[model samples]
Target: MNKIFLFISFALISITTQAQEIKWMSFNEAVKAQKKNKKPIFIDVYTAWCGPCKILDKKTFSNPETAKFINDNYNAVKFDAEGNEEIVFNKMTYKNPGYKPERKNSRNAMHEFTGFLKIQGYPSMVVINNKGQIQKTIVGFKTSEELKKEL
Candidate 1:
């Protein structure tokens, strides 16, 4: 009976921890969720070849405390700045015109959405209000504590 009780307790703890994780969504999904929850959107714009972007993902975003805070407050989005995906935001369609298979791993031309946001560097973090307007843009890498403060 004690063993069974311990197992059940462990299972519940695992579920609770997973629930606190940041649920990363696409830009469109985040926008859709915003309509229902009325929460701001957090976008992390990165490229495949960026070193700081990897650090941000591994060190900052991996922190449970930071993830929980973002999960509770904002709809998170991971945007590939040079990706060839089609994104529709604010009644406009954004695409990558110069995307090629040869440059898929390296830096290709910027996507229309990246230009629309005026992102000048890799690992740019953007905050969009619930009203679908951009609130702020912070470029470069930040620690978990720094990112929490930004949020």
Candidate 2:
């Protein structure tokens, strides 16, 4: 009976932990959620070939604490800096049809958010208010605690 109770407890704990985290959103979905909820947008801009970007996704962003805070306070957006996803920003549609895939990155660029966000480094993040004003810009991989404070 004790073993059965412990097993049930562990299962419940796993489910509860998963429930605390938010599912990541695409850029457009994040933007729309911001409009509807009047919350800030937390955008994660990364390049597929950037090692630090992979670290951010695998280590930093995957933390349950970060996920919970981001879901609660902001609309989380994830974007690839060198992806072929066509996106419209600030009334202009940005594209980069000639961007070649670099190293082992999965695809090429078809967007100009790289320059628009002034991304000088990999694994950059930007926080924007509901009015489309930038609140903060963070570069590099950040721990869950650090990002939670920002949110």
Candidate 3:
């Protein structure tokens, strides 16, 4: 009977831990959501080949406390800096016209939106206010504690 109780308790704990994931959305979806409910936008701009970007995802964004705070206060977006997706912002359409599909997993053309934002490095965390204006841009990998303080 004690063994069964322990198993049930562990199962519940696992379920609760898995439920703390941050709700991530695309940039366009975040923008549209802001029309109904205004919230600051947190954009994680990363490239596939960036080592620090992967570390940031595993260490910082995956933290349960960090995920909860971001979900409660911001619309989080995961954007590929070199992706070919078309982005519409501030009455302009941005695209990666020079993006080569063959080089997708490696270094490729930068998205026009990335140039518009003037991002200088991978794993950049861009904070946009509820008014759709940039608040801050933090470059490189940050621990969960460090990222929480910034937010």
Candidates 1 and 2 compared by TM-score, better number: 1
Q: What is the descending lDDT order?
A: 1, 3, 2
2 or 3, which is superior by TM-score? 3
TM-score of each: 0.89, 0.79, 0.89
The prediction achieving the highest lDDT against the true structure is 1
| lDDT digits (tens) for residues 53-133 of candidate 3 | 999989888899998998989998999999988888879999999999999999999999998888999889999888878
- What TM-score does structure 2 among the candidates reach? 0.79
**What tens-digit string does per-residue lDDT give for candidate 2 at 104-123?**
26655535866777777778
For candidate 2, the 10 contiguous residues with the lowest summed lDDT are 101-110
**Candidate 1 lDDT, tens digit per residue, 49-104?**
99999999999888889888899999999999999888998899999998887998
